[model samples]
Target: MKRAEVLVALGLLVVALVVLSQAIHLGPGWGEDGPRAGFFPFWLAVVLGVSSLWVLVQALRAPGGAGARPFFPVGGRRLVLTVFLPMAGAIALLEVVGFYIASLIYLVIYIRLTGRQGWPLTLAVGVLFPLITFFIFERWFLILLPKGLFGERLLPF
Candidate 1:
């Protein structure tokens, strides 16, 4: 388990480094406010890379690290899939369903899958969280999230 954890962290570190490199290639805007398209991405990639490396280091030093344990322990696979699969689905859903629907679906799925709670609670949170986020980001901040089938036409900001 520890070994796999370290490997995954290392992989994330590598990916972040790649993203950082790509971002750095895109020069930031010059003069006055110096933020370009890649400014945030590049910095975020740096932070992610550093953090991933730190975690990798800790895992390497820890007892029963990834190399010492089974690749998938009892309940490990379920835990990993439950967390990662939904996150991947959320990203994929962004293009197809857009942000609101995709986020709502993700919230609902997360509640249902992880919480093991009742339908009422799951539905309430799933519905409310996205609505609140929609209002906060779209209405308040004047920012737009991805739109899928249901988009600006139906729910214009």
Candidate 2:
């Protein structure tokens, strides 16, 4: 567990550093128009780097030390896969069916199977959630979301 934590922290730190470098190249300061392209990324990378560093330090100083404990308890892998596999499938479906449809499918399956909720509640959430998200992002915010391979033909929006 300690080893895993340390490794993950280090990996995140590396990613943070890479982003920070890119942010610097892209100009992390504010311009006349407002914040530069890299402003938000720069701060986000800094925060990630600092947080990861803290985690790495804590992991190194942990009582049991690296590799002294199991990364996951009994049945942990199964538990993790139950959630992860579905989400991964959703991501894979995104490009094919679009965000709204993929999310609706994912939410329905996740809520129904993992949460063991009644059909009414699951169906309500599955359908309404995507519709609400569509309105919020497409109409209110005027931000275009992916509409899949069929695009507007799929939703007519």
Output the number of the lDDT-best candidate: 2
**Which ranges of candidate 2 are over 4 A from the true structure?**
2-67
Instruction: Please give the distance, in angstroms, between residue 20's alpha carbon in candidate 2 and its true position after superposition.
Output: 15
lDDT tens digits by residue: candidate 1, 1-157: 7877889999999999898888878863452576887788888898999999999999988899345668777888889998898899898987787888888888888888788889999999889988998889988998977887665555665
Q: In model 1, what are the clashing residue pairs, if there are any?
A: 1-66, 2-65, 2-66, 3-65, 3-66, 3-67, 98-148
User: Which sections of candidate 1 miss by over 4 Å?
Assistant: 1-67, 71-73, 153-157
- How does each model score on TM-score? 0.54, 0.59
Scored by Cα lDDT, where does model 1 land? Answer: 0.84
Residues 17-67, candidate 2: write the lDDT tens digits: 999999999999998899999999999999999999999999999887454
Q: Rate the local accuracy (lDDT) of all candidates.
A: 0.84, 0.91
Best-matching candidate per TM-score:
2
